[model samples]
Target: MSFSPDRSQASEAAPVTGSAPGSASGAFAIATQGLSKRFGNRTAVDGLTIGIPAGTIAGFVGPNGAGKTTTIRLLLGLVRPNAGSATILGHPLTASPSYLPRVGALIEAPAFYPSLSGRTNLEVLARLGGYPTSRVSELLEVVELSDRARDRVGTYSLGMKQRLGVAMALLPDPDLLILDEPANGLDPLGIIGIRDLLRRVREQGKTILLSSHLLGELEQVTDWLIMLHQGKALTCGSTRDLLAQRGELVVEAGDAMQLDLVARIVSEADYVVTREDRTLHIACPATFAETLNRQAREAGATNLTIRVKEASLEQLFLALVKGDRS
Candidate 1:
């Protein structure tokens, strides 16, 4: 509801310029300053500040009710923030009309006229949004809906409908895309199709903000991440930096006594240790694996198998969320 623009002066704001991706300014496609949202007794988004670089795929992730949807709504200007401000392509939300035309979005489950054919439905949307009807065929092909273009929405499967929704979003040829759960309820093939489609979009030099519960699939396409928990940003940075910042060293000794000694020595070396039976999990740099093995041997711990294990994105997300709760 808050996305409504002040039509009179919305387009009068200085035309967007000088902030293109890779410019010396290092401008962002999306930027927020202390954005927050609340409803009655609950705070949905709290003091969120993040920047999404242009021409990159950014994953917006969190557990259920972590304010992922609310944050997306706020970013799109559909919902106003209680405090703070956001800019898309360097234009304030109030001036969104000037830039939103260049943005596309498919939030949650988009609805279509079940009685209409996929192509007809898109044509209706094109007319309503004042987009060129010529894009209908082009987008249908882009989303792989061309073969089913004449099929009624009611006869289409969930995956087909999702594809049609994406086609609808692309009718305007947007520069940035905001997709929420695009892979939800999709079968393996459908999921793979969406992944490939996203990759193609990125190859076209478009920026994308994707949110989903499918962490594995998300990891395949995202280069940057903004993780949320309990309505707050737990951590935000490039995916590589966050995952490579630390790693786990798993050590399994021959006996309980050896494990205990290993934990003590590792802790003394400024590493956090977790013990599970005869295994010691130490949170440290991968480079420290040799030090750990040598220390175990010096302490007479035989049959000790020490190996370095890198944390995956899923592991990193769980660890960050749990750490914040603690």
Candidate 2:
């Protein structure tokens, strides 16, 4: 269950110093500064800077073409950055060899021999990676695939395959796990399984960088969040901190005039308001819900319904991206 490697085996390239400004090198499992990558005239990642604390599930999210994959490639040393620097597991990007062994990644769909049993596929990977064969069995148990270990991978469901992929990543007993869309194409139950598995992985003291588009699912599991847009980090912080920044009061009245009155009241109070048919969406704190309800009643609105809604990951993503574009 231990992922700690011998400190003596660490890179001699000297640990990166203050790469994330105001934070010590040991503060982050992954840190990047001014990291940029380009493809001819198109920039994939632009001066990207982010810090993912150790031993936490950090959600890596963005719209398509946001440079998420490119950043992952850069981190894995699959591609060279056109500019900036990065550090993984205390080793600079220039010394990826020293740290990559401790990092496990499953980017995109995992490829496996359809005809091979799930156990055999893992055994093959373990042998090729020089990992202990015993880890294969242990991982099968961890991914809850032991019952189906002898089953052909072709017979496995997409969820099972994803779990197997995770098992392969865990085979290295990595200290850091980076998964790109592990829940993609999964049903609700499969997604829940992945979430639970991630929690189990984190309990083993592993830091996880989960890149996924399922914001609702991410909101449930991620302790930290890094929102990417146009190859740059638009916002990165603890999930609680990010979501706490915005909330809304949804009000619906029996008549259009009542709705308009409620909207005017919210707007006059300096809160942003948007009208959609009979509903009034007021951007404000949840704490104001009581006051809003009282105000509507005092405004002579006989039939009114009000609800306070917390900001969801989807809402935060849209708000951040919209603000960034503006």
Candidate 3:
């Protein structure tokens, strides 16, 4: 998948050589420098510098109240910046030309005319917005709403409304799609549907900036991630490089009770136990896995499985924000 960005007089796609990549894709679709926002005495975004690459599924993830919404609002020109500058697709965001048609956004839960049918609403918007009438049906099909195109939006379930909102975003045939918590109202299957649809958009050269709290699910679909903590960028990088928590291997043999004994015996292994039905997982330094394996063997254990399980993005996040020493 690839997204080609318009070339600016001054390049916004250049890498921050002093900083790590916020996304895996080569060129940036959105860039910010020293962007900050303050609401009276409370600072919502503080010196945020983010780079979202073209056509990549970049996860802007953080705990609740970490300024994700505020940052998105600023990028969309809904809120003025208190400092720094931001650009989208090679143009200063504040100086945006008549190029908004090239972008689509679903910020928060999307709104629609409750009394209008889905197709009618899209048709109305299409007519008023100068888009070709032929686009409505195509976008309806894309969002899998063709079958219910005539249903009133007010009668739609939350998941159904979300799909319809995405349909509306697609109606404009945008190059960049920005979604804030797009999966907020979706069911599990609906979430999968949205993820796959976004991937398809990437394949067609469209970039996506996705903000979500569903970390476990997003990790499966996103190529890169940016985590914010207390209104500041904590870490941002490719999924594999940023979240790989490597640790020492703790090998345990025998049934569940022996595993329990191993737990007591190896209490000082410098790792916490991750328990499964019949398995135990622990994180440790690379040096301790071998020693732990040998010690388990000496403790009268015949059955053993010993290997390192790398950390998930959730674990890495906790470690970074809450570890005794990060």
- Provide the lowest-lDDT 10-residue window in model 3: 1-10
> Which should have the higher lDDT, number 1 or number 3?
1
TM-score of each: 0.79, 0.79, 0.75
Clashes of each: 0, 0, 1
Local error of candidate 1 at 246, Å? 4.6
The order of the candidates by lDDT, greatest first, is 2, 1, 3
lDDT of 1 by residue, 175-221 (tens): 89999989889998998988888888888888989998777887777
The segments of candidate 3 whose C-alpha lies over 4 angstroms from its true place after superposition are 1-26, 245-306, 323-326
RMSD (CA, Å), candidate 2 to true, equals: 10.2
Query: lDDT of all predictions, in order shown?
Result: 0.78, 0.83, 0.73
TM-score of 2: 0.79
- Pairs clashing in candidate 3? 248-284
Model 2 C-alpha lDDT per residue in residues 1-326, reported as the tens digit of each score: 01111111111222121135535658889999899999999999999878888999999888788888889999999999999999999999999999999999999999999999999999999999999998888899999999999999999999999999999888889999999899989999999999999999999999999998778988999988888888878787777656644567778778898888788788878888988988888876555666667777788875888775667889878986787321
lDDT of 3: 0.73
